[model samples]
Target: MAKKKFPLAHVYRLLEPGPVVLVTTAHAGRTNIMAMSWHMMIDFEPPIVGCVVSDRSHTFGILRKTKECVINIPTVDMVKKVVGIGSTSGRSVDKFKRFALTPGAASYVKAPLIEECYANLECTLIDTRGAARYNLFILKVHKAWVRPLGKIVRTIHHCGRGRFRVDGSMITVPSTIK
Candidate 1:
């Protein structure tokens, strides 16, 4: 039997509607953050998250070594910084310093959370097989913190190619009487 091959763009589009995530990692004394829209929550009991990171990315190395990361959820105002982080590499420059981002200490992991973000989820890598083979890392979320003030702001959603959309008005569904 033969397997079907698909274009990268087509594969990416399938992963659309993925929330933008800031993959933060630290090893030794250096730390870095990268923007990724290819992330999703896979489990609920232990609160697991799956994120795709290129094997060649510097963050991948740090995550591999530390086995921990912080998924920072940014607001619509952070679109510029999100795009900037995605464009640059942490190996060449300190992304936090280069982008003027503040890092706050995490409660359970060595990886620091982006202070300016709307929400932060500290996680520890529990599965590495996917990362090695498909550049996908599965993390078990240890804790989550949300900013009260930032919650009012719209969430930033990526639409590929530097394009983004802010979260719109909310709609509530009423429960049917049993």
Candidate 2:
């Protein structure tokens, strides 16, 4: 087998995280949604999540000031809307209305959850030490919601360069931890 060099700029495609999530935030009565794929679980007991929200994004300022957000996991069925949300800014467009997405109130956070998503996690900002340098925001999940889907929920994962991968099958493997 032979291997070739891969571009550093496209490295993110190889390490795409779990899923592309729609992050909802509200500030001063204005709400916004930003599509995020650069998130990862940091802890299990309290459910810590580390996500990168670009400093230039509209949601970044709101998420920082309000210190809370809803991480909505959209399925493959809503791929087009997800891409649309990522392409446009809330400053000019009303995402909920433009994308025809329903906003549901969260129990803990001020941010509304996207009803079209398979799952939603209400989170509060826990740390911003890395935000200045890396745009990383550490969040603590205060509450969670999951729709009762009869079959497997196929979440979308961004592979960079406008490419995406959908959740496929599930396999049971022996584990000692659980």
Candidate 3:
């Protein structure tokens, strides 16, 4: 068997940690949504999450100022809308109206939950130490919402270059840690 060398620039595409999420933020009187794929779970208890939001993005400024946001997990069925949201900026356009997505009130945050997503996590900004150096923000989830088990759908994982991989069959494995 032979293995070919992969480009260093594309390495991140191969190591995407989780499903693409639509991060919603609200400040002053407006709401915005930014599609994010560079996020990962940092802890189990209290559900800490760390995500990178480029400083240049509109959501970055709002999140920094408000210290609140909703991480909405969309499914494979919304691939087109996810891609469109990622490409468009929330600076000039209203993503909710442009994409025809419903926004529901979040119990713990000013940001609205994307009703079309399978799950919505209401989070508060916990730390910003990495924001200046890496554009990273640490979040603590205060509340979460999800559809009934029977209604849940497979999530979509970004693989760079406008390509995505959908969640597939599950394989159970024995584990002592929980």
- Top-TM-score candidate index: 2
Candidate 3 residue-wise lDDT, 59-171, digit = tens:
99999999999999999889899999998889998999999999999999999999999899999999999999999999999999988746336899889888888887777
lDDT of 1 by residue, 1-178 (tens): 9988878776765556656878899988999999888888798878898888998889888888899999999888788888899999999989999889999999999999999998899999899899768999899999999988632568877766776777867666897942
Off by over 4 Å in 1: 1-11, 150-152, 175-178
Worst 10 residues of 2 by lDDT: 169-178
User: lDDT by residue for model 2 over 1-178, one digit each (tens)?
Assistant: 8989999998989987999999999888888999999999999979999999999999889888999999999999999999999999999989999999999999998899999898999999999999999999999999999999866778999998778998888877899973
Runs of candidate 2 with Cα error greater than 4 angstroms are none
- Whichever of 2 and 3 has more TM-score, that candidate is 2
The models' CA-based lDDT, in order, is: 0.86, 0.93, 0.93
**Candidate 3 error regions (>4 Å):** none
lDDT of candidate 2 vs native?
Answer: 0.93
Write out the backbone clash pairs for model 2: none
- Comparing 1 with 3 on lDDT, the higher-scoring candidate is 3
Note the residue pairs that clash in candidate 1.
Answer: none
Model 2: how far is 26 from its true place, Å? 0.7
Task: Please give each candidate's TM-score.
Answer: 0.88, 0.97, 0.96
